[model samples]
Target chain A: MDKTINQKAWFLVLPVFAVVAFSAILPLMTVVNYSMQDTFGNNQFFWNGVGWFKELLDPSTDLGGRFLASLGRNLLFSAIILAIEVPLGIVVALSMPREGWTVAVCLVILALPLLIPWNVVGTIWQIFGRPDIGLLGYTLNTLGIDYNYVSNEFDAWATVIVMDVWHWTSLVALLCYAGLKSIPDAYYQAAQIDGASRWAVFKAIQLPKMNRVLLIAVLLRFMDSFMIYTEPFVVTGGGPGNSTTFVSIELVKIALGQFDLGKAAALSLVYNLIILIVCWVFYTVMTNAGVERPAKKGGA
Target chain B: MARIDLVDLAHSYGGNAAPPESFALKPVTMTWRQGGAYALLGPSGCGKTTLLNLISGIVTPSRGKILFDGADITPLSTQKRNIAQVFQFPVIYDTMTVGQNLAFPLKNRGVPKAEVDARVKQIADLLDLTPYLGRKATRLTADAKQKISLGRGLVRSDVAAVLFDEPLTVIDPELKWQLRSKLKALHRELDLTMIYVTHDQTEALTFADTVVVMHDGRVVQSGTPAELFDKPAHTFVGYFIGSPGMNIVPAAVSGHEARVDGHTIGLHRNYGVLPAGTKIEIGVRPEFLHVAAPASGLLSAMIERIDDLGRARFARVRVGDEKFSARMPPGFSVPDNMVGLVFDPAHVHVYADSRLVEGVA
Candidate 1:
């Protein structure tokens, strides 16, 4: 068969390329340019190739020290929140009403947190956790536990973690619920007929059915938590000696707070690269999990 | 293996206070012999799956008792029933390998590891799944997955019975034949009491020693395939069992004779008295009724069309206001629109109110 080569296809792709250049590529290129150069006041610029990157990576340098500290805190925050949310989400999803008007009511309650704006969630928790006038802080203080998010590092961390959990766990629960709902009734019946216990059914049937959605939930949660800035900034303002300042917050402090655009741009590039790498790994794992191996030779 | 019996078993999804018309399964009192292969044959919504679920203890009957080997098991949970059931779609553990999927039932009941392995191996071999034992079950084709479902059902030797609810519905048409025959061979080799539920007549007839035909929510007829074909006990069975189904047309049946469209047709037996005000109908299978030249037979018919079905030819004919299907001879061509239908008197059956009426010889 003779195949026709259609060069017109390239012309059709020009508009899409133009859109990407304007929306994504141009801004990213500007950041890349700033990352590699130095600029002083009044739009003064000078070539300083790799200088900002070098300072950003070396721990002895001020920029590197802040970047590494915030990166570590971000990683720890992500780990803790994931540890608390995933299983809790699964439990909530499992307990969701299977039918009736109650299902709608439960779903609405679960979604209440996610529907709230991120800054608004931070503001609510900020007032709600105040020792002077807030319900949670006043109750905790009355119970004889020392609690003050404003001045205590431990309290700030605890308040921020709890706030993130309250705001985001519903997303994970909703995803897992969709996965659970896709499972056919036959699996549960078959499991019962097989004399399987409740735990066995969860392990064998429910868990396997929810694998794909769980992976997506984990990936989304990880990325969102790693890049968290607005909520904690409003609640803690990276207080108690920079304890709650995540990588994104630290980058913003350098770029906007200190007016060190070159250093901030360098930090932004590295942070974006890390997210891209992790996302790539997750995508590869998900796609690989779905691929079937070719059948072995000499088999019926 | 155990003989499973249902004593007045019935179910209504609407609960105990619901009226009889709301019953999903009408009361059924029947005993399934040990090691016998029985097929519940019916169209959709005919209570086949409901009955299967009742036997498997998936759905509790609203009334009556179920016994396994003379022990009441109606109140028992599905886990306590000791019966295996395959659903319409294959229910397999996606994370498990084929070997593990087959071994799951045995493993759950705390069977010895070595025995579990042996039983899994045996079932895999029987289903020609030996080659895929190490492969993940989720990666297999639909038919292979269905085989895995069947394997899980058959893994335990002491199960009272195995119930299949249209297990081959997801299989490809060509593969359906192979899988069906495989199930038949497994039934014979294992000597297990198997109750297969299907709407397809071919699957039921070819796989079962006895076929129980159901209609509405009731078992209308239960007999061997040959008996169901030769003497259908109910009009539903007569209409449901055949290829073109039996040619059923309204008629006036009297002693040794039936009148259709003011023409008399002979009957082999005497239906002395039919119930008053009941709709009387005579049924004869297409195989027993042949198309003949005009005025050559007892009743005249107008030939509407001739359908050549590769294996045989059947003529769609109309007599008065009723339509019928009759077999056409290989060399016979329509001489005219008007023709005669020759019915074998022995194959003629009389039905009153859709219930077959046995006649005296």
Candidate 2:
């Protein structure tokens, strides 16, 4: 039986690998080439020998001095988003009914914002936060609160965070909702028979069951928040003295604004590597949590 | 153990003065003795599960009260009622070990750690799950997982009643017999009040001391296996409880004789006060009837088919325009076209308008 086989099945997977390699590997090679060389006008290039990497890693007399701080901000933003969005999504999912017209209505309404383009979300918030005529800005000023997102770094960061929340919290909520729906009613009945309190039921049954989807939500949200550029870029233009400037925004400044392709390429590679490492860690932890141990004797 | 009483319980999902005729379960009043093993037996959509759920407080009754040990608990939540239930499918914490799954109820009730460990071991030993206690429940086979679910219910000694809703449906055929006997033994050893609900008549009859036969939202009869088999209160119970089921033939009664399919069979006793126009039917179990020579029998039948069932063979025959089954022992030869059926008059039951005619001969 082990020797009997047909090798034709390999044909089925050829197209997928080809498409992935073309899209992922080719661009990655171009980025690697750009990272190691200096390019002047007219497409001329010269070898630089890791000069950009050394400069970026240094702490003084380089724009890369702020790299560590920006990385820290990115991590902080991801953490805050996960803490707020995951719980908020779960709550909203639980509040929806198991069946009925209301469930459909709520789901559709929650999904409407996620379908809009990211750039459009930035523009909408940019206009909406105007102090002179925008509803939020006008309301705040009328309420006698001093608010200027254009000049205040704190206001700019707050506005970007809130905008991101509005645009992406629904994704997390929808995924968690799918996870919640997959749980059988028998578990609930068993929990009831066990005399578990509401908190205990949530902690033991709901949370453990939702571990897989929550991992996906955390990883996706982390990557999205860390690489966030469009909304904050359109709204703040990375302004207010670089206070709200994330790594992506910083990369854009290096490549397009200053036209330093080599340094930008190196920074982009670092950004990709950090995301890859974090995602790998999350996947490993989540997969390990899902592995079930085989039974042994006399332990009960 | 507790004496559970359901007093005039009726439920309706919508607002209506009278429950819709299509109500899943009609009003029912019944009592189960403490430590008695009972089963609710019926086909699908027969409201057996609704009754079980109502008793467990998973569904609150729209009318009347449920009492446990003489105290009203109809309005209480399921957690407050302390009734353990094993569902049709396995329900256990996949993330937890088998021992943890069994100990969850005890831990939730704030039982001491030592007692919880003791109770867990006791149930594991009883269920033959001692060897798999440390293993994660999700990694077990379907039968093993079901055992974990059963143990979870049995581990809690403080539960008022253990309600099993077709818990053996997922078990394999061979293991089903073993588990059924194990459950029966568990009931005797623990003396816990148990209510098992199943559509399978064999499981209900063998496992339960008292079988509550239900049909279409009503309890047709509640009796021991012997009584339910010998004399069923309703026609549905007669058809449902037996292997070949009771053969019901429409007849017209005149004095002490019942004219069935243009042939008359004498009755040992007369049914008095029955109107002449009333619809009557004669019911008899196939085992009580025997095949005989044509002239010596009460009626003649055309043998249609013979089913060879190892120890006994059932002859399906056509008597007049209706078909009836007669049980015959193995090695008995059935004649073609012409066959004779002789039934004891004492074992015959007469029904008028779906209700048994009490005191009828």
Best by DockQ: 2
Worst 10 residues of 1 chain A by lDDT: A291-300
Q: Per-residue alpha-carbon lDDT of model 1 for A183-270, expressed as tens digits?
A: 8898999999999999999999998889899899999999999999999999999987899999999999999988888898899999
Worst 10 residues of 2 chain B by lDDT: B11-20
Model 1 misses residue A176 by how many Å?
Answer: 0.9
- Give a tens-digit lDDT track for model 2, residues B1-361: 6899989887765533654576667888999998999999999999999899999988877777899999999879998897999999998786788898998988889999899999899899999998888878887888999999899888888778999999999999999999999999999888789999999999999999999999988888999999999998888888898989998889887567788877888776787657667678988888887676577546988888887777788888888788888986555675555778898888788888777786544
lDDT, candidate 1, at A248: 95
**lDDT computed for candidate 1:** 0.92
Interface RMSD of 1: 4.6
What RMSD value applies to candidate 2?
2.6
Q: Given the true complex, what DockQ would model 1 score?
A: 0.42
lDDT of 2 at A206: 85
